[model samples]
Target: MGRPLIHRSPMPGLGLSMGITLTMLSLVVLLPIGALLLKGANYGLAGMWDTVNRPRVWAALYLSFRLSLFAALFN
Candidate 1:
């Protein structure tokens, strides 16, 4: 069955949903990650490698996934 034409949009599609999702991710996620990499490069490759492979970073990543999975399980 088809939907009623009167209830549907008549205007041409502007792809607004795609634009909104792209803009939100750029401002919130991409910018922070760009900044982090730039700052990390201030250190040479050896320092960068050491910083990334630290126990604290691994623990934080593990905790993030662990907590997220636990929350999902509860729901």
Candidate 2:
């Protein structure tokens, strides 16, 4: 006969592992993005456009793009 589908095996502590993983994912990944989105929502489209159009922002973006491209090429 085939084995039962939902039988528990030898593994343990899965819930603890999942909880820690989800907590870290929220803190490390989700929180900063949420904060950035909230800040942008408060700033509104016109303010964001003004900030994006500035020379300093353009230079920084260009530098970031170049660095990313360089790293991608090496990879």
Candidate 3:
């Protein structure tokens, strides 16, 4: 034979699929994180740290971690 036959997938190729996946992930995940960082920068580092260090924030964070741990173990 002069040349061998090449096989093709029924679905869209890897490049197109990866591009869509990355675009969706950037919109859904990265944008919010970027906005949070931008807000923190505008707030000033000291103010952001003070806000995070408050008793209410500490308690909420602790509770969330505890609940997450319990849920993970239970599941």
Residue 65, candidate 1: how far off, in angstroms? Answer: 1.7
The whole-model C-alpha lDDT of candidate 2 against the native structure comes to 0.93
Enumerate residue pairs that collide in model 1.
Answer: none
- Summarize candidate 2's per-residue lDDT along 1-75 as a digit string, tens digits: 997798775668888898999999999999999998899988899988898899999999999999999999999
TM-score of each: 0.68, 0.61, 0.65
**Model 2 steric clash total:** 0
Candidate 1 lDDT (Cα, 0 to 1): 0.90
Per-residue lDDT of model 3, residues 1-75, tens digit only: 588877877775888988999999999999999998999998899989998999999999999999999999999
Q: Name the candidate that leads on TM-score.
A: 1
Query: Which rank order by lDDT, best down to worst?
Result: 3, 2, 1
Question: How much is the lDDT of residue 47 in candidate 1?
Answer: 91
Structure candidate 2, residue pairs in collision: none
lDDT of 1 by residue, 27-61 (tens): 99999999999998899789999987999999999
**Error of model 1, residue 44, in angstroms:** 2.3
Candidate 1: segments with Cα more than 4 A from true spot = 1-14, 72-75
